[model samples]
Target: MRPKIYLYGDSITEESFGDGGWGASLSHHFSRTVDVVLRGYSGYNTRWALKVAERIFPPVESGGVPPLAVTVFFGANDACLPDRYSAFQNVPLHEYKQNLHSIISFFKKRWPEIVILLITPPPIDEDARLRHPYIENPSGLPERTNEAAGAYAQACISVAKECGCPVVDLWIKMQECPDWKQAYLSDGLHLTQAGNRIVFEEVVKKLKEQGISVENLPVDLPLIANIDPQDPLKAFQDY
Candidate 1:
């Protein structure tokens, strides 16, 4: 039985233009491996993602919905500081942390054996911060700077550790390849096709390096735990 994988996150994950976004590109790696379900939503945060996770992986609905592994990506929308991005603002760090903890706890409670991976949002445009003026309005006072983006990424790692969740550190990867602006990102935050491909490639490389092929695997496999955080040979983050 092919494993069912579900992705839950923001607009980037929702763009299923077949390999258009990172999640779409990641889907291809599983084309010959397992069944992939895309559940990316636009303008979403941890609170809503928790709801989506509940709907997708309802508790005790055996034989009703097939077993599926889940991966979550947030922070992009959460960074909208001061709760002031046009109609939204940055999610308070405390609130954001609590919301994330809720999502992880709920999933762990529902499916203790399921794989729940967390991915931090990619970098925001530094020199181009002023480009997205939609963030501030006449009444909106600036709350945070773009440099603070990485701080949230760091917080994400901490949250993963707290939940014992597997993490895919896209922030560091983008830093290593700083020219991602020309290579992968079009809107600074969201990834371009090439960028998505880069993310997918790394995901596949990590999965294969762990000896668990997504191809034709059972849902019972702990795809999350199968990945060792203490292992140095495979991931730079782990090392």
Candidate 2:
């Protein structure tokens, strides 16, 4: 019997329209036809996900067939948000790390048998990092948001290690081949179609590593790649 798998993340995992999102793309890769539930939200932190899980996942009932897996990808927003002047507030790395630990513990306690996978957020562009007003802060902390990107990834791995769970390092992969203006939207956040495809491929590989078969999937970049959002496409091509 196929096991039920749940994916938890932010915007990158919420591509509802098609296979662009790893959540949707991975659904097609399972060899034994596993059930997948995409539990994704936008602008969420690990602390929020931990609280929300109690409300999102159904309660345990004997013979109800617990989910086989639950993967988590948070911390993008936890890097801190922009202030009134559009300056990055800069979340403390210690607090960010603690939030990760809390989420891991919450899920582990709830589903001890389920395989937990911790995913680190991808990298931030240097240009985007420099643009933030707080980047000019004299304290020298806000400027480290770019550096915190690495800190956040390491924190994910640290939490996973403490909990004995596997982790997927999306940070290095994205850095290896960042598409610059194309990979991210104007906000300097969120994944473009090409970017999401890369993440989906990694998720598939990780699933297989977890002993779940996710092979022979037809992966495609979203239409966001073909037609530039700036210029409108012809009637036949627009859809």
Candidate 3:
């Protein structure tokens, strides 16, 4: 069976395989070598994610084939302010940390051989988010702020360290790019084309550091160039 890479998170992950999305890039990178499965739910915070974790990622023993790696990306919605417009999605900082730990522990207990990569929420662009047409408060600022998201990002990093998992510090790395506000994020939360590339690169880098050799994974089938048109049966004869 082909190895699988599972992506679990919120809208950012839900849309990760969209046009120019990071997940899509990863899929293309692995191609026939791995199955990139996305389990992202829009607008979900870590609190909600924890409740549904088992439903989405069941024990490996109960499944057909175990995943090679799983990425737990959350915190954007958790960073929502506990105010009128965003309270519905708001999760306390302490709870957010706990939720992350629970998610890591769940996967570790179920599949100890699986590699877990934690991704922190990217920085928010309040100005762009406020200008977005669907923003909660058209006349006011956005429900999420850069500072608030940064706090959660830090917590995510801390969780990774405690859990001994690899991490993609999207929040910190994206900011290192020049004019990241315009280049990385779309509106305030989601990633743009450039942002997606950054995420894809970082994810691969982290996986590599953890001794997961993506480049060396076996291809799913023989190369087209190696197939002989004269003897198509020759390809299947071995099987």
On TM-score, the leading prediction is 3
- Pairs in steric clash, model 1: 33-215, 80-89, 80-90, 81-90, 83-89, 83-90, 84-88, 84-89, 85-88
lDDT of 2: 0.66
Give the C-alpha lDDT of model 1.
Answer: 0.66
> In angstroms, how far off is 78's CA in candidate 3?
0.3
Better of 1 and 3 by lDDT: 3
- Best-to-worst order by lDDT is 3, 1, 2
lDDT of 3 by residue, 169-224 (tens): 89999999779999998787788899989989999888888776657788777778
Cα lDDT of model 1 by residue, 123-172, tens digit? 77643444444444444343334455677778888898998777778877
Q: Write the number of the candidate with greater lDDT, choosing between 2 and 3.
A: 3
Q: List the residue pairs that clash in candidate 3.
A: none
CA deviation > 4 Å runs, candidate 1: 16-19, 59-68, 83-89, 126-145, 206-211, 215-239
Best by lDDT: 3
Better of 1 and 3 by TM-score: 3
- lDDT at residue 201 of model 3 (Cα atoms): 92
